[model samples]
Target: MAKLFEPFTIKNITLKNRIVMSPMCMFAVEKEDGIVTPFHVTHYESRAIGGTGLVMVEATAIEPRGRIRPSDLGIWSDDHIEGLKTLTDRIHAHEAHAAIQLGHAGIKAQTNDIPIAPFSEEGTVTAMTPHMIDQMIDQFKVAAIRARKAGFDIIEIHAAHGYLLNQFLSPLTNKRSDAYGGTREHRYQVVKKVIDAVKAVFHGPLFVRISADEYHEAGNTAEDFIYFSQEMKAQGVDLIDVSTGGVVNVPINVFPGYQVAHAEMIKRGADIATGAVGLITEAAHAEEILNNQRADLIFIGRELLRHPYWPKVASEALNVELEAPTPYKRGWN
Candidate 1:
């Protein structure tokens, strides 16, 4: 097995370690205008300094209305680039590569505020129109360009978590009868364009975050993901970030490595690199995923949030490192 702390390379970018800081929306941004705040920079900086190899910033909306929360960071405008640049520079200084996850919330848009269609009996989200969908595609392109200016080494498209792209993949949510919905290929058209546009602006590796299974009572299936992953790989996606079950109306019962199955499936089924996320906390568990070749990378979310020094601690626990961070060297006993 390639040890978890060993450097891993994808394309021209070589991560100092296999540990990746998965993007988690903290809703820490102050406004919906997509401006990067000091809080966002500080939040990510902590992780970078903790010794993560790839510090993927949180889910940044590509457009204003496409935002999931009122305070989500965005890369839609030039104004957002400077703050993002500060984040990238800080992470780089700490020997970590920076990545941005660009996405639109789609019909799941504005979960924190505003109104749209197919509202619950209590009234909430509304389905997006064809016009809104088209605008989102363009927004993704513009956001990708902004990310490049901000000095991101990689751009991951958020197509998972039952957001806009996942909604389209679901027969339950996507009721559109046009080219935007129905059938597998037509449902994926919007995201495919988003990927293509982002690739045009980003010169480095590209990643596509995907929900391998919608896990809805009546929802998109693993087969749906297989088809989607295949198309995504064909479109030049560098890796598939596999996660599952974000659209459930009730709490989901899952165990550790529950989502790893999705990653394993996509990696083998599509013959592409996959990043396994969710409940991947322990060093042994992450190592197992790599040893089995189930995933190319292990993305830790809540665990990293709880212990920013997870990589360093894990390296020590695995007995694989010569020393810990200089400041924390004494604490590494």
Candidate 2:
């Protein structure tokens, strides 16, 4: 059985270990033009230097209005290229594969501009027109091309967490009667276009993050994602990063490794590689997920935030020898 430190490979790219630094928004792009600052560069490189096998950067907006916050990294234009390249270069310098999550915040966008969604439940807002949908897909494609130019090893499409793609995915929000809504397959139209667009430019390993369970009885379940995951795989997604909740603003019962089962189900049901995320803080527990063949990778979120050195410490706990940066080697046991 593979351990937490075991490597995972797909489509010619290999992650040195199973530990992935899940994308977490820092809202540190103080420039306000969707450009990342030095904080973003250092933020990701620290985890790379700390021995994380893969450092997935925070959700980077594909359009000015798609930003989750006023201050968030973006790849909407060519001007954002150099800054992102600097980030990936630093992570690669530490031998960690770098990835970027491309996303659109939709109605949840924290901007002055009125947000858009499949169907607006709030005050007057634009329901994305067919032309707007095409533009959005193009934006994702262009962002992906820019990420490849920035030297990202992987590109993860953020289709989960009630984001734009998620809005189109869930029946709770997507009540449209057009070709882009209603039935499950119809609702998946936008995501399929986004994935196809990304694949056109990015031949590298691709991943899609999805909320396997919406926690609302009327919302999607893990079983529903089995087919969605397969659809993602067919569109060239190399892996499914399984996460749950955020489709609705409901309180969910949180527990350690609570979402591991979702990842397991998607992996077995969709016949695709999957990554487990959500309150998974323990190295032993992460190893158990891999050893049991439940998940190909474990994405650590808040734990990695509270302790950037968690990967190094986790390596020790697992009796795995992970090399530290030369300057930090003295801190190693």
Candidate 3:
């Protein structure tokens, strides 16, 4: 069997294959109400029906002010739970594990409210007070509760792409003099608290997406992420979904499998499983990564967007028999 088609298990969750549909925001909430819509239901359920092992919902905001855009999906309240549950039910009905990326955009939030971050930027963003920080941790805990109530099998913390948690992790943006700043461990305090808070109520396979390479001279390097990965492993995180370059936008040289090296480094350095993302579109490359023990899972982003039935394409390319959904079996292969 192709490694890409092999089952992977972490904690109590088992993925039928290594292909993970990377979380990409659709920005399709037409009413700005932060509720799941028909478009989202169709968008994600199509990938599950296409044979994706794990269908990750987009970066869902934990609070309205934390959204990256006005239309991003949300899990901040109990009202959001019903719509999300409907979506998860569809994915699970297709035999795919459902996961949600809980995130807060912080200073990068595009909402009308004053954005919050680790440090205050003059007239730009507000520094979170200690009480606010405590509240933020509780918000993540509450979001996890909603995810469980929504019937999601996994929850991924979005700490990458220069979002709220990434703001606290990267020194380029986190310029604080308090305990949540200065040293690497200090900078990690907020993320650590967030992880602990989520793990308190979430027992499923917990994943964290991190910007392993900050793309700046003073930013967190591969070595720094090795430390972060170790800390997350110790805290019972099941996987580190490795993706790079979002903390501060610098031009990145794009290529196929460019970020796979970072995932491999973290896997070896911290001895933790990781999901390799960033331009990984080919099945052979994904198999090679897993076959060689470089990374445990392959996260396909744009390609999956372009081709919802990407796993079938991968199975054909890898010479594996991919069983299509019952109704489409005669037309498939």
Candidate 4:
């Protein structure tokens, strides 16, 4: 059997295949209230029906101000749970494990009020106060509870792409002189607390997405990520969803599987499972990564959007028979 189609288990959840529909913001919430809409239900369910092993909901904001956009999905209020539950039910009904990316956009958040970050950027962003830091950690904890109530199989903390958490992890963005800054361990203080808080309430497999490379001379280096990965492994994080860039906005040279090396490094350095992402659109490349023990999972992003039935396409390319949904079996065969 092709490695791409092989079942992989993490904790109690077993993915029928290694293909993860990486979290990408849909910005489809029309009301700007941070609630999931019918579009979200249909969007995620389609990928599930298309044979994705894990359908991860987009980067969902933990609070209103945390939203990357006004229309981003929110988990701050209890009212958001019902809609999220409905969406997860549909994905599970299609035999795909449902996951949600819990995130806070921070200085990257597009809102009327000032955005928050690890350090103040004068007119650009507001530095987080100690009280605000405590509040943010609680927000992550509360968001994890809502994810459980929403019936998600896995909860991924979005610390990548220069979002709130990534802001703390990167030196280019975080210049705080307090305990949350200075040393690498100090820079990791907030992320560590967030992980601990979430794990206290969440018992299932937990994942953290991190920008392994910031694409700048002074940004966090590979060694820095290795250390961070080891810390996360010690904190009971099940998987490190490895990604790169978006930390300092420097230009990145994109190519197929460009970020896979970081995933492989973290896996080997930290001795933990990792999911490889970024421009991995081909089945053979994904198989090579898994077969060679470079990464544990393949996270498909833009390609999944271009081809919802990408798993089926990959199965065929890898010469494996993927069972389609009952109604589509005849045509799929």
Candidate 5:
């Protein structure tokens, strides 16, 4: 069997293979009411049917105003649970585990509502007050609980991509003088609180997506993420879905597996499992990473978008027989 087809287990949740469908926003939620549409159902189900081990849903907002795009999916209320349950059921029916990235866009939100952040911005948003900070933590906890109720197998914290959590984590974006700011330990306080809150409500495996390299010299780097990963590990985080350069708007010289090195660093340094993402398209490349233990899982994004059956096709490319959908069961290994 190919290494990519090997099962991976974190906590009690075990994936059928090492290939994970990286959560990419579909922007298919047209109603802007935080409900998952039929588009989302088909979009995610396609990947699961393609035989991915795990299918991570996109960055879903915990609050309406926290949406990155107006059409972005959300989990702010009980009303959103049913649509999410449909998605979970579709994924499970295809024998793939489901995960949803609980996220808040923060100051970067495209919506007209002013976003709250770690630092107050003039004529726009304000630095999060202690009360607001506590509320957001509870929101994350509630979102996690909702995810569990929706039948998701995992919950991912979107602490990456200049989002609310990353804005707090990045020193350049966070300029608060309070306890939620200043020192590195203090900057981590919000994330620590979010993690604790989620763990309190979520019993399944927890994952956090982080930009290991913020690209700027003053921004975060792989080494910094090593520390963050260690802290999350201590807090019972099961995996780090490693991505790079989303703190500030800057050009990134991206290439295949460019972020895999970062994942390897965090994995070895933090002694924790990690999922490598970024331009990792080819099966051989993904297999090599697994073969060398560079990362625990390979998160395929754009390629997965272009080829929903990438995993099934990859099995053929690697000459490892893998099961396909019932109608296409020529290879059922």
Candidate 6:
């Protein structure tokens, strides 16, 4: 079997291949009510048809207020179940395992708002109190229940990109001198609570995405992620989806695979399953990452968005035949 086309299993789920569609926020849902639309369905279904082994839904808000933008998809209530169910069933019909990335926005809650960049703007962020933290945990638990009901095979908690959980994990953003801040263990408490709550409600596998390093002058380092990964594994986290930067302003001058070192560190330091994402476009590059045992999975973001049939093209380029959906045989070029 081709290295990238080989099957691999994580807990109770088995991925037909290693090529996974990285979670990309499409902001396709209609209205501010966070309703899933046909656009959302078609976006993911197309990826499934393109032969991705595991199709992860975009960064879904676990709470309505956690929405990054007005049109982002969400799973905060029971009403979202039907639409998500439709999307999951459609992806599965194409023979791909469906996964959902659930998360809260935290300090970076509304960073995507163009007019008022939270980093530069003041008075927009509502400091999350201890009670609010508990409420956030409950929201994640309920959202996981909804995702499981929606037919998702795996659930990944979005902890990267300086999102809610990431904010708490980063000392730079989390200035709260309380239990949810100060020390590394305390900062991690918020996500740990959310994880415990979700595991109680959902029996399937759980994955956590993390910014191995904030990639800033005053950000968490690779050593920080190694410790976080160790704690995550101890808390029953199945995989660490490693990505970097985003805590502060990004320097566009950084070279490609600059973040891959974070993935390599987490895998080696923690000896757990890790995924290397960011600018991973070529087949040889992806295969080499896996072959080198740097990361167990490779998540393609912008590249997959530019080419929904990337998995198909990658298969052909790698001399591997990906299983195309039956009805699309004529267009399998």
Can you give the TM-score per candidate against the true fold?
A: 0.92, 0.97, 0.99, 0.99, 0.98, 0.94
What is the lDDT of every predicted structure here? Answer: 0.82, 0.90, 0.94, 0.95, 0.91, 0.83
lDDT of 5 by residue, 1-333 (tens): 889999998889889999898989888887789899999999999999999999999999999899999999999999999999999999999899999999999998999788888897686886789999999999999999999999999999999989999999989898989898887788899999999999998999999999888889888666678889999999999999988877788998877788998899899999999999999889999999999998999999999999999997798889988876887676554
Relative to the true structure, candidate 1 has a C-alpha RMSD (angstroms) of: 2.5
Name the top lDDT candidate: 4
Q: Give the runs in model 5 whose Cα sits over 4 Å from its true position.
A: 330-333
**Model 2: residues with Cα > 4 Å off, grouped in runs:** none
RMSD of each: 2.5, 1.2, 0.8, 0.8, 1.3, 2.7
Q: Which ten residues in a row have the lowest lDDT in candidate 2?
A: 1-10
As a whole number from 0 to 100, the lDDT of residue 192 in candidate 1 is 84
lDDT by residue for model 2 (204-322), tens: 99999999989888987666688789999887799999998888899988899999999999999999999999899988898888889999999999999999989888877877787
Give the 10-residue window scoring lowest on summed lDDT in candidate 4.
118-127
Per-residue lDDT of candidate 4, residues 83-116 (tens digit): 9999999999988999999999999999886899
What lDDT does candidate 1 reach at residue 207?
95
Error of 4 at 117 (Å): 0.9
Q: Please, what are the lDDT tens digits per residue for candidate 3 over residues 92-123?
A: 99999999999999999999999999997578
User: Clashing residue pairs, candidate 2?
Assistant: none
Better of 1 and 2 by TM-score: 2
True lDDT of residue 62, candidate 3: 96
Root-mean-square deviation of Cα positions for candidate 2 versus the true structure, in angstroms: 1.2
Worst 10 residues of 6 by lDDT: 112-121
| Candidate 4: residue 104 Cα off by (Å) | 0.5
Candidate 6 residue pairs in backbone clash: 105-164
Candidate 3 colliding pairs: none
Model 5, residue 108: C-alpha shift (Å): 0.5
